[model samples]
Target: MTEIHVRDLRTADPADAAAYAAVRRASVPAMPATAESVAYTCVHAHPDARYRALVAEADGEVVGTAQVGLAHDSPEPGQGYLNVYVHPERTGLGAGSLLVRTAEEFLTHEGATALYTWVLDTPRNRAFAARRGYRASRTAQFLRLDLARAALPPLADPPPGVELRTAADFRDDPRPLFALDAETAADEPSDVPAEFDDYAYWLTETWRHPLLNHELTTVAVVDGEPAAFTLAHTDGDGRYASGMTGTARAHRGRGLAKLAKNASLHRAREAGCTEAFTGNDTENGPMVAINRWFGYEVFDTEVRHVRAVG
Candidate 1:
């Protein structure tokens, strides 16, 4: 007989965080996971975020986990998300179901009217979400590039008054980056619209994120103004990911986004990152083209599943 139990994350226990990270890495190899990242998220969630990290244990070992929370940054109210991952080795133990149930109930109680999740495009994963009342919405592709072999675009010399810099250069004052992020994020294509008007929240959640690579994050500066940037994150294991890349509205159409990303990728490769990963909405043609130009190949895809709840 198989038994399963779901419980909240014990941030105080490093072992618990490590176990959660292990399960996540085993379940979703495309995503970067680390014990420090798990602990940082648990410890620094915004006061109003109402976040929960639940782990499902079967036969005395954690076999599944979920990160459930409201989309507090979205302009639309009552939007929530629940992403569940089950260890590939422990699938038949009922841990996945238990984790999903627990996560749904938590979101429902928090007044979420809609819940969105990303299910890997695999048949089994799609079926699991469908059976749970989620209808597929849109698909996104995950692309990976072998940094060691991929030839990155040459770094162009910044125009006379323009300069290239890393995120660390702004360590003493990151408000400029935060402002640029807010502007760009507000216009990103997504089912749930976000409004990043809260600087303090972004400071705590994004700027201080554990995996963010400040030195590898390339920023484009024009006349000392941050115009474009590519945020980089690393897992300390040779894997690097492009967390976000965007250019200010006025700076768009000038290849600034591409420039920043190329610079960041080159820096990551030089820093010994062997693999690079990034995701783009299927409809985001420009970004998809940019990644393709960088020699990234589509490796996996996930479809967003959404369900309505009272």
Candidate 2:
């Protein structure tokens, strides 16, 4: 008889982190994840998040992983999330179902009233979520740019009074960037509303993440003040991804965000990165247009699904 079981990931074990990252990479290529990044989250995640990394094993071979957590940063209480992915070749082994059951029980015990997850936009994936009582919500498009070959737009001088800078320039202090990030993130469309009030948490969770490539992360300055920025992540294997790109409310419509991202892409290519990846909500038309203009092509889509927890 084949047996499938789920258990807490042994975060201290580098082998466990590698297995978790491998499953995630096979299941969702657009989302950049590495063993180092996985281990970092397991160690540095906010205490309030009640985060737990889980793995499913079939006859003692790891075949699936799930990231389960409460949306502790969200203004709304009881918002929980769990994303489960089974190795594509091992799907019929019942690992995915076992992981979901285990994750749901854990979240429900933590007082979650609404649970959300992302399901790949495929017939089988959508049906899997639907059968599990998840109702689809919003969709996001994964885009890719051939940074090594595509003709990136020529670098142009920043408009008068505007200067281009890198995230590394703020090594002495990053509070200003935090404030701008908080402002722009607040305006992002989401089912769970998040408030970035904890600077210490941001520093621990985001600013210090291992995948963050500070030298390539570009920021735009208007009149000596930070206006827009693009956070960059690189996996050291010629792969680069844009973690987040945003502009302060007061600086919108000035193309500052695009200017920063373009500059960052150029820097990433110059730094020996070959493939660039980014994602945008389908509802975010302005940013979608901007990404398209930079030659990013939509490669995949994911649907956000939510279910009420008792």
**lDDT tens digits by residue: candidate 1, 242-300:** 89999899988888888888888888888999999999999988898899999999888
Alpha-carbon TM-score of each model against the true structure: 0.97, 0.98
How does candidate 2 fare on TM-score? 0.98
Model 2: which ten-residue window has the lowest total lDDT?
A: 25-34
- In order, the Cα lDDT scores of the candidates are 0.89, 0.92
Quick one: RMSD of model 1? Answer: 1.1
Relative to the unseen true structure, what is the C-alpha lDDT of residue 44 in candidate 2, on a scale of 0 to 100? 93
